[model samples]
Target: MSRFYEIDPTPENYWRAIILFGRNTASYKFALAKALLELHGNGKSQVKLEELAVPYAKHLAQHIKQQPKQITSKRSSFLEQITAYNQGQLDHDGLIQQTTRLGFNNVIDAFHKVHGNDVGSRFFIDQRRSHGGIELTDNLNHLLEQLSAEDLAGEVEARWRLVEEAWANNLSRQLMLVEYEEHDQQLIGIHSQRRISLTSARPALNGYQKGRCFYCYREISILYGSDTPADVDHFFPHKLKRCDDGKPIDGVANLVLACTDCNRGAQGKFDQIPALPLLERLHTRNEYLISSHHPLRETLIAQTGASREKRQDYLQDAYNCATVFTGSWQKWQPRAEGVAVF
Candidate 1:
């Protein structure tokens, strides 16, 4: 059975749910929650809804402006809408319309409202209330305390990066701008004036993985430019399992740097549990990420749960879930034989 099965609806679990399942514009809600948790600190501080809006809007604007242009359609995204609202391009009613269109009203309802009763009842007080503010739940505040301020900030930034990458990749696929060719498993994408490129995390990941493809263990070039020839692969194929909330497992823990051949070779191999050897490599890679002070460590712990035993259990559960779709584990052998072992 999946570890996620029979999970209790505790505050920590609720926070994890948001991390695992929230996607696209809904990701801003999680960012808002984290910011609120940080700002409120230890006590039960009731913060005004308007007070939360400033930081949330700022985050949304920064993310929107920084995203790759190709991934962004001509039509403005919710992030752009939020940015516009913050920049005074939109009136209060215009902001409301954009937020509603982006489905943020549902996100707010989900966070503030209790499990049952009116879904949108009140997780936090609405603007209609005399106080018109949100009170941080004790459980949430406690959860936030598990990480230091630096760690919390790093975690939030990492999550934002993953969300941005995931959206861009998905948009490229949806628009039929990205295609996978069978020959050499090559990926072809419509190149715009500016191509989507990896950030500093690429070098960090390359160093951590010893400048080798995570799947094939072949040495990959470490060129640091837009035309650099390495592929950032989703270790767990995004197409395998559809998330009800539209979020895929695009967290750093689920990403690996690969060569063009390995990435293309594994195309559409969704819901297939990699060989035990690959899984072992992945665990080691995660350990390297944790020890190297990467923000991904926090995300890995959050998804798999803390403690080594829990992490192993979570991975086993993930493999089990994959088997349901794939019928059996799929082992990928390195195409290039006699590659230097790390």
Candidate 2:
């Protein structure tokens, strides 16, 4: 069993063999194993029959060859069960063996057999969750290193950089068009008809405040620029005709963090970020920051601030604008009906 699943993770030099040549030829496993044996380990131990990488008896012509669709998920019984064992979730393998998810068993086994025990191979396994339960915990760090040398990373980073450079040239002109809240120490200078190319800003939105979502606690994705990452939000409603322009706050002052849902969403952006009572104060202080809900005004000031008076109100308002939706350190939970997915 160890022979089928185990791979030596030590001896970093062995990894380069697979990392480099595997992209061009079907001889990837042989080339990698030979490199390991020759440069680092015993040369005499090379895989003799190309048994390591070749899943079928036939030799593959290329590295990126479309795997033959001829092989179906149906397996020859015990072959399927053994796969369950290596996946680490050996516990669930038995339970799922006869279920509709059976194809999962065969696929997992074949996957583990080919990929060995390395973390990168887990992504190819039949089931999304393997018998061996832990995935990203064990997978990400290991695989990232392997992929570091892969061609794809270089291409994505390079393409993204060009787009970014083009955007920077347009930033100053764009900033001039925005409208901000006319208040002391506002978080961001707001904008009007401020449009950013989401494609170029994709990296910043996800990478903007770090690897996390600015408001919600989801991990930012590289692809998120297509629509998932955070966005610029208005501190005050632009619709009430209170503000002269439509752009949300622009600079660090009026700007706070927000997820895509809250920005495009119909809920009052500023009101949702601030605690309910404090929102009332913002509404009263500036018509631009007006809180339409009169009934909730006093209550917001009472619970969210340090004291019932003016001094505490200033502190709370400042805190609300600066750190309100930005950090995950303090979690926010909106009360909801009995059942909810988020």
Candidate number with greatest TM-score: 1
Model 2's TM-score against the true structure: 0.25
Over the stretch 204-320, how does candidate 2's per-residue lDDT look in tens digits?
Answer: 222222223343444434343334444544443333222223222332223333455544554424443445443443333332111211111222333233234663454344444
For each candidate, what is the lDDT? 0.50, 0.30
Error of 2 at 69 (Å): 49
> What's the TM-score of every candidate structure?
0.43, 0.25
Model 2 regions more than 4 Å off: 1-199, 220-248, 251-257, 260-342
RMSD to native for every prediction?
A: 14.4, 21.6
Candidate 1 lDDT score at position 238: 58
lDDT of 1 by residue, 1-342 (tens): 112112344444344334433333445555565566556653556766555555555556566667633123455476667667657798766654555456344456555423232321123544424665556555555655542343334344544554455456553333212222323332233233333333334433443443467776666654534332456676656554542222225555666777776677545223445677677777766654444221344445655567777877766666556556556655555554224333
